[model samples]
Target: MSDIEVIVGRIGRAHGIRGEVFVDVRTDEPGRRFAPGGTLRMGDKRRPATLASVRWNRGKLIVSFAEAPDRTAVEQLTGELLYDHVPEAELPSEKDEYFDRHLVGLVVRDHTGAERGTVSEVLHLPAQDVLQLDVDGEERLVPFVSALVPTVDVAGGFLQLADVDGLLEDVE
Candidate 1:
């Protein structure tokens, strides 16, 4: 239950008859996250399951765990989230790359130094990620791309957002 554990995937429906399950991956690095022998923590239960095998099916990752050996066993894992229980420090160090967990709860500010709100959530969309903020009790969706976000100072505890016209307007 540590904050350091990052969600790597969510178990979908059973893929085939041999206990293989389709995973809706959340991480950018699927090969590492879903690799054989990698251990993933299951949702709520926090049960550690080792990846016994993994295969790519039409760009989707179908995985089998040692704990789940049949379709019936994999069925129990449907809708469960898979997390990589690794410390943030152990993650790859790359410029401008950040885990969504680090951005949550950070104060979001406009380029003019005006406080917009606090980050409530981080939405990972197919095209890009978004920062969901709570401003004056209203929700705002801000694209997390460099062009709009510009800066993220986790140590400083704030996110600097570029001024995009009507970007902070109330959602209708």
Candidate 2:
């Protein structure tokens, strides 16, 4: 298997006595990533497991793995990160869309072509996606919107952000 792994979800807590666990999905396509019969890796070690079942409960996802047969078994998996080795070629081809893996580590620059920082992470919120940047040892959360982030030149290894006053201000 490839060394590259894309984190898709984080196991929350054991939901029921039958080993079902709630998952905080991190991928845009939860249905595909958390689908039954899909295989997912756990943690940095990449422990392999196959999804025995997947279902929705109270607007959240509940998943069961073949390795986890009871609440006691799944409880041990709580807080574990789930990952899939999705190749770059399999990423979405829609214009102006990018995978989180592609965005991370890209240089961030202002409209005037001044270097600001590097993308450290991508936060997927319910309202919108945000880019987490590491600037001068400080973290900045920039909204990933067209108005604010005008260009994403992945090939060029950089992205341009519109200068928004107070947007990059340090937050306490």
Query: In each prediction, how many residue pairs overlap at the backbone (N, C-alpha, C within less than 3 A)?
Result: 0, 0
Instruction: Kindly list the per-residue Cα lDDT of model 1 for residues 38-63, writing each as its tens digit.
Output: 89999888899899999998998999
Q: In model 2, state the lDDT of residue 63.
A: 91
lDDT of 1: 0.86
* Candidate 1 ranges beyond 4 A from true positions: 1-3, 91-93, 170-172
Over 4 Å off, model 2: 1-3, 125-127, 136-138, 168-172
The global C-alpha lDDT for each of the candidates, from Candidate 1 onward, is 0.86, 0.87
- lDDT of each residue in 22-43, candidate 2, tens digit only: 9999887787688799899997
Give the range where candidate 1 is weakest over 10 consecutive residues by summed lDDT.
85-94
Q: Candidate 1 at 32: error in angstroms?
A: 3.0
